[model samples]
Target: MPRRHDPERRQRIIDAAIRVVARAGIAGLSHRSVAAEADVPLGSTTYHFTTLDDLMVAALRQANEGFARVVAAHPALSDPESDLPGELARVLGAWLGGDRTGVELEYELYLAALRRPALRPVAAEWAEGVGALLAARTDPVTARALVAVLDGICLQVLLTDTPYDEAYAREVLTRLLPAPGTRDGRGPGSLPPPTAG
Candidate 1:
């Protein structure tokens, strides 16, 4: 028998790995399982990914794109005149508003980094990517803080299975943002200073 040309085999395997993780979580992800899910030869998975960690790294990288795509779709996030906190809260709402299966899948692969050393760098990429986008609106410190707060908010919502409150999220995010005219004298995305009541 001759070999068949399947250009999308690698991507198919990655997609299958994501589905497997979504259904059975990281514990259920294996080359055999991915092969069956992808419907490619078992050898194909092994050939593409030498180890489970390799496959996981690919899946995590792909999963991390879910939120990034949402963020990218909102150009206002990069604008200085936009309401940073409100925009971020709105973005979070949009991400969380859709079917949660993708969100769960992304977080599962992200959390797997705790036990899988190979996945740590890939997991960090998600934070780094978001931070870079936020850097345009604020200082590096604030950008990093925003990432942390966003992560915490997402975790809380997912863990508690509570409805996402955009208003609460915007208020919480507002506290982390620098007051107007604070960042390098470039007043972009600055919320008014809080009143002392």
Candidate 2:
């Protein structure tokens, strides 16, 4: 069979960049290093991605798409009108309340994005998607808060040897957020009234 030009092999490099960033953060990314990890030719790296920005953009795209895929993977995660307190919590728990490699990978991906300007937009897009998901039942301010909380809780779990409790996370965030339709997702309005009582 003839080779497939415009092949997914390029995507493979991008995906590997995400993994490498997940494994080693931004410092670990390089055309040659990623090429080795992907087991493709180093020249293929230059052939597929000529600039660092292109590579970073590709990696960010991979990460953003991957997270969205995970969110879409669950039926409950997409439906904001559901019993959000319970469902949102479950989704948050599933996404971060475990010791899953994805959470760890996300940490690395985010950390790498911090120093890499080219990748910053990639991170922002992913954040916006997650924020939008949370905003479904709450306001934008809270949506941002929710992502922060999830990341914080994940960090806590990462630091500790103790077992994770998805239930607790669900309960806590449920109490913190307002009910669905209480507000129209911080759209065309000022921020949600000061959340802290």
**What are the lDDT figures for the candidates, one per model?**
0.85, 0.69
Clashing pairs in 1: 80-189
lDDT of 1 by residue, 115-195 (tens): 889999998888888898898788889999999999898999899977788877777787777775463344444444532
- Superposition error at 15 for model 1 (Å): 1.6
Per-candidate TM equals 0.87, 0.73
lDDT for position 47 in model 1: 98
Candidate 2 regions exceeding 4 Å error are 1-6, 22-25, 78-81, 97-99, 160-162, 179-197
How many backbone clashes are present in model 2? Answer: 0
Q: How many angstroms is residue 118 displaced in model 1 relative to the true structure, after the best TM-score fit?
A: 0.6
Pick by lDDT: which candidate is best? Answer: 1
